[model samples]
Target chain A: MKFKQYLPASSSDGKAMVSLKDGGTLGDLLDTLGIPPDVPKLVIINGISRGVSNTVNAETLTDGDVVAIFPPSGGG
Target chain B: MEAWMGKILRVNLSYGDYHIEEIDPDYLRPYLGGRGLGSKILYDEVDPQVDPFSPENKLIFMTGPLTGTGAPCSSRYMVITKSPLSGTIACSNSGGFFGPELKFAGYDGIIFEGVADEPVYLWINDDEVEIRSAAEFWGKTTHETEDFIRAKIENKYLAKEIRVASIGPAGEKLSRIACVINDKNRAAGRSGVGAVMGSKKLKAIAVRGTGKIMLPDKEAFHKAVLHARDVIRAGPVTGEALPAYGTAVLVNIINEAKILPTNNWQVTYFETANKIAGETIAETILKRPKGCFACPIACGRLTEISDPQNTGMGSPKYFKGEGPEYETVELMGASCGIDNLAAITKANYLCNEMGMDTISAAATVATAMELYEKGYLPEKDLGLKANFGNADALIILTEKMGKREGIGDIMAEGGYRLAEQYGHPELFMGVKKLEAPAYDPRGVQSMGLQYATSNRGACHVRGYAIANEILGVHVKTDPLITEGKAEMVKTFQDITAVIDSSGLCLFVALATNFLYEEIQSLINAASGAGYTVDELVSIGERISNLERLFNLKAGLTKADDTLPKRLLEEPGGPKGDVCRLNEMLPEYYQLRGWDENGVPTTDKLSGLGLQ
Candidate 1:
């Protein structure tokens, strides 16, 4: 299985996929994703995450596992 | 008398008159104040047929009942006028300390009419008002104007915090899309209100008021304000995203939705969006977060752009300025097919300096670029080798537009007129005479509907339906859906009208008021009055109807409820489908209790208390 997330503010599209070894939970995957805790808002798996402890569905993840993350936005 | 000064400052330039008028209590109850109250006055007093740039047209700057009352984010003021760009009623709202200052100065509104014989600026201290010569400030930028006003006044007891709303060369040149800027680089920055001020020969408004502004119920208001600020600080949008990266953060999300207008609304996707994304700004250029008066959520940024070229190795000077807000980024960056954030920020400074609206400026530049590409507009017309992605064209033409010189002369006229002048009127992408924002309606269905019927001509603040379509706040609806958008647009419009009228910035409602019902509570807390969600929504409908009545008087008909040819006939993205504006307009009209032709019925008008 693989985990992918984007740091939108940095223009980092998270197009690079990370392969997770068997038996890794979302927490481990989130940890490996390496989003700094101090980075106020993170679009973790299409949801806002204040902490990296947010769980991802590592079990459902497979090769080419693509998850898009977004930061909070304003100025409409 | 607790918070509101309950007075109006009237300035007539043509006759050289300045007087103070007591506000009508009845008008305040129904309209609530700010943009809403201003719209009601414009609809009732002025003839709709009056020319927008004429001395006959009155420009009303108003604040809400809650303004300067210690209510959270109730620091915004509105500029209401018949827009020179749209030829319809315009209400552009902005956040700052000026609203509070005006309240302290014992006035609820400032109404100006007629043209002065020469350049002049308004000076208000408490109950005192004066119009002084602005010969020294005739050609200065907005920034310079503010500095000059502060320097000349030199009032030590006034706290050195005189808030000034002024224009740049663009407004003096009467560009259709000039903006009124204040503290924190906040702006009533959409329509041509700046041009109206220019036409009146007004240079700037400098206000200093020390009278304590109080809410009707100070204890209640303070508690409510605290709650609202907490909500703002706790919300994800305000707490995390905006504080971390400011408004420019939306660059990637809108691009992901594939709705970010790229290269003149032709492409939804931009490969260069990453280059100008929010994170890049925060990392490379962002210096510190800037904020408006009494706002805890300081989403504004004071930034400096330094690069390898500015390492004293290449350019002698580096660019430093206030922004590249999301709209400026998308409009100036992606829409014009320019991805450089530093370049976009520089252009923003130019817009502010020249008194231009970045949204309209970028959109017009894109229109001009499209013309150049089609060979309809010669390169010589622009006084340069004009093309998209050419940063030089963006920088120089902005200055020209400020001065209304050369190609900038025609470009300053706005997209619709510029296209009309070249005999290819279809090239213009706007509703009425004003240019559209960064969102291409084809991608976001509700936006298309909103733009089609917007009284002020293609404004986003009227109803920002994009949050639902793209950001998926509350409930996510498919961005491609046309059905039921009538209700969505109406609902969004009504909610926003209340927000604008209340004197709070919209960001508070969107990011802070996560639970929809909390918005009503917050307003209740500040006003010390209670209303069901229904009454608030009705206010929105009423404001819309009022604006419609004003526009009808301005000679707009069902024909005016239209999308540009490009949005209606040519869809460019994956679906290649044009906006079904025809299908949406009728439903929107029906929802607003209007006739099939988009005119407000007499009954509807009467219900809203319109004359």
Candidate 2:
């Protein structure tokens, strides 16, 4: 999973994608990466915005699920 | 009293007469200067039915109380007038040394009225204010005008202390989308305020002041300003992200969220959004970063594009300038389906040099591209193929728009007018004839309500509901939902009104995790005005209601407060969503104490002391 550096618990370099265990839920992946489940304002898995109902934290991640996490930052 | 200069400079261009007037305390109390004071004065003095270009229309330059007070990011000034483009009340603010210089010159604001027989510019050296002929500078670009004025004012031996606010050829031609450029790059860049200046034949206002700005409680003011700076520094957005990537950081984020408004908003996202993203710009064209007066976070991108061939663009093999801000990148690059960052950068430079609004100009071009793609516009008429992703054509079209030559005459009229001229009013994609910003309402649901009801005609800066809806600055809200957005929009609008008047950058209000109390403390300490946090919030609401009243009087009905049909009806993004404006507008009106028709009730006006 690629994380924007601004997000909490993301790698300092913001480019490393860690391999996760098979059938690991998104929460387990976040826990492995030390990211709090509630930190990201919006999470995208392969370009679609996942609502809270379909949050990455609860959804199980497959082998090739690419994730992008965003923080609460703004500009016009 | 200490924060405000407590005076106004009134200039009549027709008579070439200038006078200084003591600002009424009552006027300053409720309005509180800046946008609030400027809007109140515009509503009071100008007839709503008068043409925007007529001599009867007044142009007011206003600064906030914190301006020139050494407050962090406190160098913003507003240009308020009736917009020739949108026919709505226009208040566009710019940040540079000009605001502080005006305050230091012992005036809180300047009100320009009547029309000049010939081109002229205002020169202020302390109290010696004079109306000088600008016949020699009639055709100069904004950068040239500033350089010429500065050179004419000061000797090379002395330091450059003068600051200027000037218009360019775009303004000289009275393009409806012209902007007033300050410090060469920063602009009061919306609502055709520059056209208002051009109609009056005013070239620029150059000011030099050595006078000091006094703060009532200097210690408290210092403490408050320091604390505010600290708060800004502590935030992740203001402290780190902005300095690193500037505003262009949002390109990927918005694209990721699928709300980037690509190709005249026909789609929600662009395919090559990453090419023009902040990270890309930082890695490629960005040379350095800059900031306005006393700004702690330098979010301004001072960039250069040296590879024209690689950029796939026009003249200027090596270009150097500021910005191509997030809005500029989106509207000029992705929104037009031209992902060439250099092309967008060049377009941005043209807009700055020619004193044009990037959003308006680019959106207009995007609309033209859409028209051309649909066979409504012929390549023969355009002199070039304006197909989507035509980088070279984007550069040429931008230059033509700035010069207002050939087909650029129609293009210069702005997106709403351009779309209407092409026989497609519904394709305008704005409220009250003003073009929408980079955000697509179908994606960020609350932004639809914000743009629909904004007094300034489809401006995101008016409310910035994106703070809650997208960025979650204050709190996270479901971007796809309509519930609770009404209350959120109202609160954001009111708070934004306060911030706009308070002489602080809106970024502070957005990025800083604080409330009205800290802002009130800063204002009270600086001005010795005994205003509580609640009073400040009420004043914000009052200013908002006053602006709403102006728009209402100007013939903006509830019907005018609506999104484009596409947003209201069509599917958006991969999720196939649509803006629930109907679901939200009624709740928004109710929360605002407005009638079902969107007019504020008499009691609501009375409660705000606006009646």
Candidate 3:
């Protein structure tokens, strides 16, 4: 998986390359990266928002998916 | 009379006289204040086709009822006038201490009509008001003008309390992109409002007040305010990201999304965007985060540029100021393909000091660079290498634009005129003649519709679809799809109108819990208007239609409500998509109760009480 992390508190640097087990969910990736569960984040997989909700963890991740995680941020 | 000061000061600069008028309570219920009330007044008084710089074009400075009421982020003020750049009704909003001060001075707004025979500044100390000759302050920069005015106030304590909103050399030179700078750095920073101020020969308005705004129900208002503040503090975007990184934090996120417009919309991503991102600013130049009055977010950046090599001729070697905000960094840095943070910050300081809108100034420079590269513009015209990524050229051209010197005279007219002069008006990436902000609309579908239909021209803040499309503020939508975008854009535009009218910073919307209900509660508690959420939203719709009527009367046609040719045809996104504006426009018009040609229907107007 190709991971892009915008949260400074994340264990991984800005961009990271990680190999996830088959049938791994987004929560697994978060766990591998040491991202805390309580932290608010907006996750996007292939430009679609996997919103920061309880159901987000159950959303299965696929191989080669571009997972971009950002802490709550906005601009005009 | 509870929240509103219930009085407006009208100054006839031509006659050097002023009058105070009472604001009807009925009007307050419908129009609210700030942009809504100000736009209603401008539409009623000024001829739609009046020359923006003519004496007939009145300039209004307005504040909302929530302003100075100890409400969160209640520092906003609106500058309403005819736009010299777009020939449309311009309502530029700004935040700082100025608006609250005006409210405390016993007026909801100030309207300046006609041209002054000589340069002058308005000095308001509580109820006392004067139009004093500003001949000595005519040539001063905004910062210097504020300092000079304060020094002349006599009472040091009173002077310290003074808040000044003034234009600099750019406005004095009638630069169409000139903006009014307040509190040293914050600006009413679009649509040439400052040019209108300069046209009237008005130098500045320095105000100091030792009064308080009366809230009808202090207990209820305090409760509502506490809840609102709690919502803001609880949201990660408003409470953490913004306060920690400032608005420029969007740099990396936008760049990562491949939607950050680069090289003046020729591309959608900047490779070196991280170098100028908020993190970099925090690590390098950021002194601290600043906040407007009663603001909990505090997204404003207090920065310093210490590099002597970054300074241009006639500029200080070391300087401190606010911003290089997201728009500034994007337009001046990435849009020009220049990654030098110090150089970008220096240019930002110059734009602020000289009182120019950074978006238009940099976008115009970028257009000039494109024209120069294409051989459409001659090198002899600029007398410098106007190439992409040339930091020195950016700095020099920005200074010249502010001063209206050399080719910057043409540039001061803005990007559209600059490109048209060079035989390629298609190259100007803007809508309604105003340069587009940082986002490449192709990447975010609803933003395309927002830009095309924005009453004030190409403004992102009118309806920031990115919040939904990218940040998932309200609802996350697929950025590349056009489905349901019309409704989304319309909804955002209406809510934003209400927010702008309420004297509250729009950043409050970033908070997950701060929605229509929160806004309604605040308004009801403070103003005693007792408007339901639906009523408040209808007020926004009314404001929108009224501004649209003004624009339509000002000679804007359906043709003017469009993105530039580049955005319409060019594939500038990660997925090589263009803005499918056609799919959304018809739906948007339908949603807005407008006819096929984007004009509001008689029934709609009547329903909104505009008829």
lDDT for each candidate structure: 0.76, 0.85, 0.89
Q: Which ten-residue region of model 1 chain B has the weakest summed lDDT? A: B307-316
DockQ of candidate 3 is: 0.41
| Candidate 2 positional error at B350, Å | 0.2
What is the Cα-based lDDT of residue B316 in candidate 1? 47
Residue by residue across B145-250, what tens digits does model 1's lDDT show? 8878777765565537788999878888888888888763678898888999988889899898878755556677667767777887887677767877788778
What order do candidates take by lDDT, descending?
A: 3, 2, 1
| CA deviation > 4 Å runs, candidate 2 | A1-23, A30-42, A45-59, A62-66, B157-159, B308-317
Tens-digit lDDT track for model 2 on B463-582?
887766666666667788888889888888898888889888888875656568767877888999988888888988998888888777877788889989988998985467898899
Each candidate's fnat: 0.35, 0.35, 0.52
Candidate 2 docking band? acceptable
Highest DockQ among the candidates is held by which one?
3
lDDT by residue for model 3 (B251-356), tens: 9788877788787789888878889998889989999999999999899999988789775334557788888899999889899999999999988988988999
What DockQ does every candidate get? 0.24, 0.33, 0.41
Off by over 4 Å in 3: A1-13, A22-25, A37-40, A46-50, A53-65, B311-315
Count clashes in each candidate, considering only residues at least 3 apart in sequence or on different chains.
Answer: 2, 0, 0
